[model samples]
Target: MPSDGFRGLVYGDWHFLEETTSKSKDSHVSSNYAYSMGIALRGAHYKVYPELKYDSVKPMLFQKHAAMSINLRNTQPMMLQNVQMKAVITKQGVFSQKRIFSVNNSKIAPNSIVTLPVQWQFDELKPGKYKVQVQVKGENDWNKLPMTWKFIKNIKVDKKAADNINDKIMRKPINKWFYISMATGGLMLISLVELLKLLLTGSK
Candidate 1:
């Protein structure tokens, strides 16, 4: 969460390759925002989270908020009356709800910073590669600025620590005998305490 009001919403996940580019290139070229592109070299799995929510229990499970932002200026910027943003998470191109933002630039300067929200949830998601696409609809055309990313399984959220312990118990019978022995010892210890209390109280 950014106090200044910039966050990276989970736009889903996408697979993409990485390459270096020069700073002098144009925005439309693959090298223009080369820094924003390329993240799919690790393997075929990555998790994408739209704007991340702060959770104390599983802080690392969610994606970090977007520190990177865009600065726009309207030089007769077509009165960008409507600004719609959306996030897509798959290669098949399934999209989330379109968040339409209304901005009246006529009253304010063109350099004002605006925050965009991106969040998503999947009913049943397995470990795999996902494409994250951020689309912004402006005055004339739709800015389908695509970025590739990865999605990995969140083991902590998906599996509980107690469940892991139970699994360990089930894996081998040796732990079961140990547990029985410990329980027996605990009972004997309790009985010994009671006997000592009685003896101290003169058989009361």
Candidate 2:
């Protein structure tokens, strides 16, 4: 249950649909907007929805990389066109940090499901609760109108995992060139000593 805000269509979740007709008149266009309050507006028939599969009830590790597996299903009579999904993750109370994932333009067959590749990083996120908001939108090949659906999942970040990941990230990197240089110097010293011993033996 989502609301359409108060004082607007008062019927809750109902939006007055407006049909606009425009005609060109001498380099200018005149528009006629028609609306009837009593008339029920049959909104765009949504034939597609997203199903995000994961254990959202449990806390998740705040790893460097995380993925939200989702599948888009089309249940319409005709195939869907230009289907795309956008996923957004924002801190519950904080507005500064945000992560976004996008699904490129794709096509879904009628009565079929399309898996989407959605991955996000939590390396920079603080250990707290967040909401993953996903939106799937597409158009029917024959219907001319676009349809959109939305979904949300609540998730919590594990503090222990976050601490471990941050500790690993903050650790200093090892210097491999230092070890290589030391090995080269040791070999050269050994070769010089052997050369000196051979010189003495030859002279004697």
Candidate 3:
């Protein structure tokens, strides 16, 4: 990894983790969602990185992911005036579920970073490149800075790769086995009825 000899190594299988934060109070307030979380100019920050490979088969089914730490100190000497941070996942242009945290009720000094651990499960994610963004909002204003990441749908882990493995989304559907059993029972009942009818007609 020599920076001098190798100017840069551009490869398709590689991606860089990223961090994004609000630049100014105006920028913060301008963000509709971020502004609502209670953010200030200098103390807040967000980081994004690959946590782990979620599964092995159809590896694209899920991915281990998390967000940067959230510190109450971002509000500084002045306690948070209705402040919180939120993280979300999106594909194509649609947003998914969000995880939210609050600092307004806590005591934080200025310039400190607070972190909330996120172990999230994502479904309906196609195999391709996607973006994950975090927006910090203040009750009075919005701080919107976006950090984007590239996800490559390659290999999935063993636990998640198995098609038969039960998933959060898959558990709700009716079982295929149940329907097969029901159909078999109906056929058996019909056959018994036909046999009984034939016996009765013969006796007549």
Candidate maximizing TM-score: 2
lDDT of 2: 0.56
Can you give the lDDT of residue 60 in candidate 2?
30
Candidate 1 lDDT tens digits, 1-204: 224432222121344556655544455554522223422121122222212211112111113221112222223211232445443333222452221223332221122333333322222222223333444443321232332222222122233432332332322235688899999999999999999998999955
Error of 1 at 47 (Å): 42
Ranking 1 against 3 by lDDT, winner:
3
Query: For candidate 1, what is the TM-score?
Result: 0.20
Give the range of the ten consecutive residues with the poorest summed lDDT in model 3.
48-57
Using all chains and alpha carbons, the TM-scores for the candidates as numbered come to: 0.20, 0.40, 0.27
What is each predicted model's overall lDDT from 0 to 1?
0.32, 0.56, 0.35
- lDDT string, candidate 2, 59-128, tens digits: 2332334443455555443555687778777767745467676875775555455554344443433677
Top lDDT: which candidate number?
2
Tens-place lDDT per residue, model 3, 1-204, is 224332111111233444454567555542222222333322223221111111211222222332223222242222222344443333332542443333333222233344433333332323323334444443211222322222222222243333322343232356899999999999999999999999999999
Q: For model 1, what is the alpha-carbon lDDT of residue 70?
A: 20
Ten consecutive residues with minimal summed lDDT in candidate 1? 53-62
Q: What are the RMSD figures for all models against the true structure?
A: 20.2, 19.1, 19.6
Q: Cα lDDT for residue 39, model 1?
A: 23
Worst 10 residues of 2 by lDDT: 5-14
